[model samples]
Target: MKIGRIETFYVPPRWLFVRVESDDGAVGWGEASLEGHAEAVDGAFEALRDRFIGHDPRRIEDIWQVSYRGGFYRGGPVLMSALAGLEQSLWDLKGKVVGLPAWEMLGGRVRDKIRAYAWIGGDRPSEIADAAKVRRDQGFSAVKMNATAELDWIGTPRLFDEVVKRVEAAQATGMDVGLDFHGRVHRPMAKQLAKVLEPLGLLFIEEPLLSENPDGLRQIAELTSTPIALGERLFSRWDFKPFFEMGAVDIIQPDLSHAGGILECRKIAAMAETYDIAVAPHCPLGPLALASCLQLAACTPNVAIQEMSLGIHYNVGHDLLEFCSDQQVLTPEDGYLRIPQGPGLGITIDEDAVREAHKERHRWRNPVWRHSDGSFAEW
Candidate 1:
């Protein structure tokens, strides 16, 4: 079917959803947002929509090429995210026509259900422990939280004590706690934090420092045996080349929507597997994106676990599964969510819920933090 029109909505709690309608009745959905910047992503989609207006919605790879290589100055959060959404939408349309789920179309399932983790709050040790217990009670075997609220290049010993206490509280539940540095700590602090958390046992340390400096990443990697998982900020597979070649990272966390569409992320996952690095697709977004992640995880040999924001810290107005019609389809029983077995991206959007929530779309931006001396601090 030929592409008829592309529509977008900047939905609540910082998400942008795109709907691609074909000449026939086929429709596909995709989520492309980097927490903030929903409007920019929408503009990116609008600029690229003309290329697919009359093209076959089934030719996802060709459209991806046209949208990607089509722009010599390409591959940023806005463009790749936009292209990623369009590509996912096309795949959804194709899968629906063939009457198969995205994963099955991508060469069937590898595991029964991919293991997923919940996110616990950062900074508060007591609160984190209580949160871990709740998640464990709800059957989640793992939870991820920020290692620290904020940190300087070298913070106080009190901060380190607080970090250790948080880790201790989480470990009390006997559930693996993945500490996310959120790129808040520089290498100096990241190295020290890794050493401290090692005693408590960690699932992985996410973005210990930023992924910007690969050499610095190696420094953090050598300092601690805790698995270093990075690359949520990276937009393309090429961006991950140095990180992989360095052989420092034990796990690569590529967001399916940000890195590329399903096929591209699958290829990236395969590359990580060759490096003996595990894949845990980073998705703090919606169900369509989460479904795409699961599809890639299904065929990927090294996907250790998936990250889903069920009751995450940022769900002020919207949540995972609320935007979709088939919320029950994403039912997480005993910690793992069953893969969506229907055609296309598997889950269907509740247009009504989406439109209603879309009406109250939020202009969400991450808060900026500063140190006591009025110097900028990472948040």
Candidate 2:
């Protein structure tokens, strides 16, 4: 059937949902949004509708190529994220048409369940030890927290002690703690964070330095044995080549929403396996996003863990599954999420819930910070 109309809704707590309808009667839904820039991605989604209307919705790969390379200026957060959402919708449509789950279409699952991790501590982390205990007590095998806040190019020893205290609290729980430097720690602090935190046996240190400074990461990697994980800002396979060659990273954390959706991430995971690195798909987004990540993680042999934003601090009034009709299908039980067996991306959106939340759509932007000297700080 031909695609008849494409409709989009900007929903609450920073999300955009796209619904594709065929001339016959098939309907599919996709979430095409970046956290703060949902409106920009929404605009990109509308721009691509010209190419999608009246085309075959089932032509997944062809449409993907048209939506991505079809543009002259290509592949950044807004453009690629728009394309990523559209690609996920197409996959959802295809799976529904075939009456199979996304994983079945992707060579089936390599493992029955994928280990999942929870987020603890907010942007500027505090109460990390308490958060870690809470997550573990609730049956999460692992939890991740921000490494530091507003670090300078040259930070003081007090900030290092603060980080150490946070690490010490998390380690007290005996759960795997993944310290995310959040790319806030520069070379000076990154080295210190890794050197001091390594003694705590961190599961991984995420984004020790920004992906832009792979050289910085190389130095950070050399200084510590803690597994260095990067790639939340990276878009495609080409963006990842430098990290593979550096041989410093122990894990790669590509956001399924940001890293070209499920199919391309599978390709990346395969590439990571070649470099002897593990995969932990980064997802601090909603349900459809997490579902898409799990589909990839289920089939990917290199995947070490999956990041879910179920109760993450970024989720204020809403959560990962706030819009879903059946939350259990995207279930995380005993700290592992079973691959969804339902058709398409395997979870259905509650349109009533969607429209209800749409009534008060969010104008969410993160807080900006300033240090004592009136210089801007990373938030």
Clashes of each: 1, 0
User: lDDT by residue for model 2 over 1-379, one digit each (tens)?
Assistant: 8988876667767777777888887877777768788778878877788888889988887887777777788788888788778778778888888898888888988898888888888432347767877777756888988877667688778878888787777777777788887777668777876887878888999888888888888998998888999888888877887899888688998877777777878888889999999999888788888888878877789998988877635587777777888899776778888888888899999988887777776777777877667787665
Off by over 4 Å in 2: 122-126
What's the lDDT for candidate 2? 0.81
Q: What digit string (tens of lDDT, one per residue) describes model 1 on residues 77-164? A: 8888887887788778888888888888778888878788988874577788888888888668888888775676877788888888
Alpha carbon lDDT of each predicted model? 0.81, 0.81
What lDDT is reached at residue 147 by model 1? 79
Cα TM-score per model: 0.96, 0.95
Candidate 1 residue pairs in clash (backbone atoms < 3 Å): 325-350
As a whole number from 0 to 100, the lDDT of residue 298 in candidate 2 is 71
Q: After superposition, how far is residue 246 of candidate 1 from its true place, in Å?
A: 1.0
